[model samples]
Target: MKKALTTIFCCILLISMLSIVEASSHRRDIYDYKGSSTGFAREKVNYSLFNAENFTGTRMDLTGNSSADSFIGKFFGTFFNWIIGSTSQSYLSFNGTDLDFNETFLNGTIDTRAIAVNATMKLYVDAQDIVFNDSLKSYTDAQDIVFNNSLKSYLDAQDITFNDSLKAYSDITFVNITGDTMTGDLIVPNLTATNNITITNNLDIGGNMTLGEKITFAFGEVIDNIVNGVIQITGDLLVTGNVNATKFFGTYNWTEDSPLLSFDDTTLSFDYAGLNSSYDSRYLNLTGTNANQNLNVSPFNITANEFFGDINATFVKIALGSGSPTIDQMQEYLDNTGSSGFFTGGIISDGGSGTIDITAGQGFIRTTADDNAPLLSFNWSAQTGVAVTDNTTQYVFVDDTGTISLNSNEFLEAQDNIILGLATDEDGTIESVFNLGVRLEESIGQAGRFIRRIHSVSRDVRRGGLVFGETGTRNITLTAGHLWWGRTEY
Candidate 1:
């Protein structure tokens, strides 16, 4: 009982000392890593005495203060280390004097990247994935636009909206279609709507669209060389640039560069044989500028009175005042269309050449049947002015460097003559072409139409044979998983 009371008194004294230590703040030796240019930096160093430039054979503690070989009962005039105890460990710190940190501070390098903001944070770029751009694109791939052949007659190509506030092209969408047939009126009043259209390949349109008004094209939008159209304008027409039309029905002024239709002062001309360099302009002009008009066809080489593209079309019309005329008046109109009747460019010209040789006079038209009605007449006109050569039989030669390996089960059918050859040692020379080939021609008699002509490239194989019949299909059989050739014996 006496020993228990003695332990209680010592416990109370220990509790009082612990309370003082809990209330005080210590300078914690924080590992402030300021530079880790690479990675982790933790180097070990030894501790030593200051006076002697030699280590005490002891290492510094983690706090870089306490040493393993610290001196006991050592005091440098009121400067004492920590009290030597056996229970809890405490670091010894000396004040009023500078510490010799010559080689004792370990892990002196700080990890600069550990506290860097860039290394620890991430940047976002997509919205749906919880990321975003600066202004945040609000696009959704819900397929709101549709494309199909049903849109042909609908003219849905002009699917543009006008924003009155902005006054510019906004909400632009690009649509593409394949094998699409567009038929309806695509009226684009403001031509700027064409900016957002792309056609990668053949864009076949089967209808017409009125560009109406206030629409113009950039340089490549319409090709000047291949622009084919028939222009029919009734009112006053004004064209700032050149016009390329197959036929024009309006009274207009044309320059020398205007094709098909041009005006040489008073003469209105149309270009015949536009696809050739040797072309002519057949025109008709009035004799005087005043009211007493005398029409003349002073320009002749003018073969026909009809236009090419017009099929059975009455070019001009005349009103008869709803009154009938006599045979004499009808005959006069049929001869000249003089005042009463409009001109019907007779029956189609059968390419006959008959010259009247009446210079600078009114033209005449005579209509008649060919070969007196029932006939099988031959007509020929040799191409003049151009040099001619000994005409040879035409054959198509297809050259291929590598082997054209075909499936043994599939049939290689040809319409006319199919010549399979090596295309010669000289790549595309025609004389060297027919050296190696198998050709098939149609026979005159009905027993067989296809005639096979084969030439041999190998002496060991059966090279030539004939196939008599209509154009039929034959497969190159596979005898042993390889294509077999030379089917016929001879």
Candidate 2:
């Protein structure tokens, strides 16, 4: 009974297991054929397997057959064909046609000997890396070729030909030509047609340069006759024709007696000639500090309107207005100006009308005419005893021998007008000479007499007279005299 129950349990577990297996779903693999449940396995999956919705993509998929829509798909579709297409061909093949790229970059050196390219637009090459071993044929059409480094040719006689127009070669910049020889006509075709060569630094030419026109320079300075800019010459200058200048700087010393003339900033100098003869001309020698300004000329002939400074000359002739005036004319001019009045020979006079005239001897008086009678006469040589006439009378006379005489045609009048004398006047009784006063009278028998009434020491009135006798020293006689009065008759 135990064995049979065990068999039944086994059978029940087996049926349960078979029923569970039949209820589960079947799984599809990569090799599964499409459109049929029972078909042969495939080596590759279909395009639908690589679809974005089918796989969980993480990296690049090179072997997939999807459309070139993703980044990895575009890169593989673009460059993979170009790499795998040609083994030994001129151009790459893509999908049985020629392949082209928008831009291609080659990081390594291209073996140009094995492969050549005919580019339509442009071929950019690094001149530093690539070197042409053979001759490159010139293009028929115009093309722009640039060299980053030197564009050198190993040929000994390589020539580059340019077109007549050279239209497109207008603005080629930073071209450095180091070769010494440049044989061509370089033209600059412009509105104002001129071929100008500009150098920024010094231009040292080993040979000579000839110019058909003049040269122009900016304004500069000069030193040691070596001029600077506007024009410069380091040699002497000689002109064949006349030279007109504002000032000349050099000296002119031509002949032996010729005058020397030179000019400077401050002065113009003129010197006398030869050394054999005495040079009387002197020039002003000017210096930075002290300069002598006194001009000295030995012989100078000048006609000028005015003259200045002190003039020392031996002979001088001057024309006053028209001609030379005489001394008398000059004196007349002085008389008109009232400028002539001086004492000469102890006499003074007005220059024009008043003149000194001698009366009798060397004595003088200012009178208008020579015949005018003198009021006083003086005799320095001899004495005269004649009484003066009326018109020609002498009121007083003085001689050199200390003799004074008073002569008049009228009475020899004298008056005791002063009262401070030794005699006192009694009253106004000295009205006339007949009165008892001091008086002079003239008579035929007597020479002259002086009569006067005097007072004695005892205050008595006495009559005294000075009698001019013929020959006597004493001529005074007092009629009634006191002890102080003496009477001497001769």
Candidate 3:
């Protein structure tokens, strides 16, 4: 019994020694401790035997070369169940060179040849991916594409190529293409119809191009020149430039159309070579010399210094010089009613010493003919300073019926002395006896002097008679002389 107890005791001591060895083999370092809990502490002590360096260097390297039988026999023991078709371990092989993954990661540089999807493919490049392909022809899987590049030459002919099956949509906005010339014809397919088409360069519209609407050239905008077929406008045309048209026509078709011409507060100058018109009339025609002529329409309120014209109207008002215009028989035929008249403000004439034969109906005022033809005839030579005073308080009979009565209070005064006579008939015979009177007042050496005289003459069926009488007082001391008088009558 003592021997049996000694054997059991020895077995118990061996089991304790194995437990100590197991514990020592799994003893963890400070860095290997994941946690301090009971379960985690046990795992940490077990896993401490396989450190990163030892597992990678010694354990995995040895296991990678060992056969399955020897590997299991050495490490896992005889009771270890085999995992079928599995190697003891596997390792990555590197021969002191860069390890190229032949298979690209999602963040690695892509081989364009490897970009193949059955349908439309969209490959998005990340920031870490740097493409190295000089020519982009290797990417053939996408239906639509968008690329962002900093270099402009990347889209040049050498860098990019197109597939005939693919449709390209390129947009390079905010890119300026200045100072570049294009040679071929450019065709834009989907532009709508408009009134104006603007191009930066000169455009040549080929063939007989037809426009659907009217073309308007705005004011202050210039068109260099136009070579056209025909421009037809369905409305009014306003032209400010020199027009070279085959024909021009205008008509008053609207009810609100004004006259063809209108004048502002300005002058209209007709400098044409000649003017012609039909069925024209005017209210006033003030014509003058052609060189410096002015056809003034309204001269009523004009303040100019001089005016010249042959003013023919209902009444002419002359503001400056004047003369008596004769209306001869021919002029009378031309103007039957004498409506064409000249009424001047003032008139002065110097018709020498001969008698001025002022015909009937001719005077400053409007006149008409009658039986007593009171024609004015002035003989300046025989009428020098003639003083004729009709101061009698009696009525003078000019003809058998016509009589002129003088004012009793007023007398006609003349500066000089002259004989009085009447207008003669066709036989140069005096036609009537006109009553007359004479008075003289003078100053001799500054003293007042008065002289009065009276005369009476009558022509009748018998021989006419003449009587003379005088009575007055003079301030000067004078002696009287014999006075003689003569009278003649028919």
Candidate 4:
């Protein structure tokens, strides 16, 4: 009985396993093989039908030489090699920083419509012409486009303006220059003669220009100009302003009015012919050697050490020789000397044969003070040509005042009348004085007798009596004569 049961269980389990395998096989066969052998063939592939022309999908026709296939195979081979981390190159190679072309050149023109380069780009080509239709801005390290080892010229259509300053390294010459207006200052630091610059038309400098070297005007004349330094010209100079020079040599002929001073040859004449008056108010000064200089006209005030011509003046005053005399001293000297007229100062001494004759007026000689004695002593002989007299002859010494005594060797002799007490008052009136004379008159009836004139009459007479007395003690002494009081007694 246990064998029968074991055989039955085995049969059931096999049936169920077979069922699961059959279902799985059917689903796979329907989905994978389209459920039949007639829907799918199991033969070998036809290689001739698998060509690029026969296929309607995106395809590439390989050349007769199979270049496309060779290129694709080579590209895949290089890609696989690069995926394996290899640096081996077939055409292009990149060694981390540089892409090398491996000395191969591109033959065709590459039209890159727009390109941007973050780093510096360099083209190592010869004879390349690059043109730009739009603007070209260079933002290099120096902010400049430098054409190395070449000369370049620029032709600007509009205004080529510099926002800051514009500098030129070499000389620039304008060949076909038109109207160029520079609104700013053009600075040239070192301009040599080899560096030449040419410009046409008018050059108007609005600012101050300093010239370090000498400037020469070869042909044209300079008008409305001033030269600060000394100017020497070969031509004539006509100055409209005043010329102040230290020394000037020229000849001038003036034809104006009022010619006060004139120079002719070696003579400087001050002609007052054009003046309104005899004296001119202008001053004439002469300097230098006075010996050779001559003044043709006389000036009002002249200062000189010596005068050559005659001087006529109403009064002549001479300075004193000695001492610095004041006005008071001069007045005292004039007053004491009693010389109040002209020729006030001088000493006139006649050492030669000269005489001071006073024929017209009365001559008076008196001492200034009373301490000086007045004496009139004469020692003149009747001899001619006697400069001095000898003291042997008697001279009458008369004392006009005080007591008079006669010398034993001298005698008084009167030529005319010897009148005593003859005086003149302030009114110039002559007064009566004691007159002792021998007057033989017909009215007096006296002859050869001494008479006294009193009121034009003879009153008291004492013959043979001598009057001897002083000023207040007069006494009469009679030897043998009678004295009458009111008449003459003989």
Find the 10 residues in a row with the least total lDDT in model 4. 355-364
Relative to the true structure, how large is the alpha-carbon lDDT of every model?
Answer: 0.32, 0.35, 0.33, 0.35
Q: After the best TM-score superposition of candidate 3, give how far the Cα of residue 76 lies from its true spot, in angstroms.
A: 28
lDDT of 2 by residue, 155-231 (tens): 22333333212322532432233333323333333323247755444555555654534443444323232233233
Q: After superposition, how far is residue 175 of candidate 2 from its true place, in Å?
A: 11
Q: In candidate 1, what are the lDDT values of residues 65-141, reduced to their tens digit?
A: 54435553333422344443443222223343533332322222234554454445532223234444322433322
Residue-level lDDT tens digits of model 3 in 1-490 = 9999999999999999999887677654433325655633333322234222232222221212333322322343222333423231232222333223333343333444345541224343432235524224455323124443323345454333432111132223322332233333445444566445655565555545554554545443333333465444545556669879686444423332224333332432332222223212232233443435554534233334664565443334433335764443332332343221112111111122321121111111112332222222112211221112332222211111121222223322121211122222222222323323221112232222111122223223223233344457643343333332222223
Better of 1 and 2 by TM-score: 2
RMSD to native, candidate 4: 31.6
Tell me each candidate's TM-score: 0.16, 0.18, 0.18, 0.21
Shift of residue 201 alpha carbon in model 4, Å? 8.1
Instruction: Give the poorly placed runs of model 1, Cα more than 4 Å off.
Output: 1-244, 251-490
Clash pairs, candidate 2, are: none
Clash statistics: count for each candidate: 6, 0, 0, 0
- Residue-level lDDT of model 4, residues 256-347, one tens digit each, is 34567776544556566554444334444334534445454433345568665544331223466657655233333433443111111111
lDDT of 3 at 227: 41
lDDT (0-100) at residue 476 of candidate 1? 45
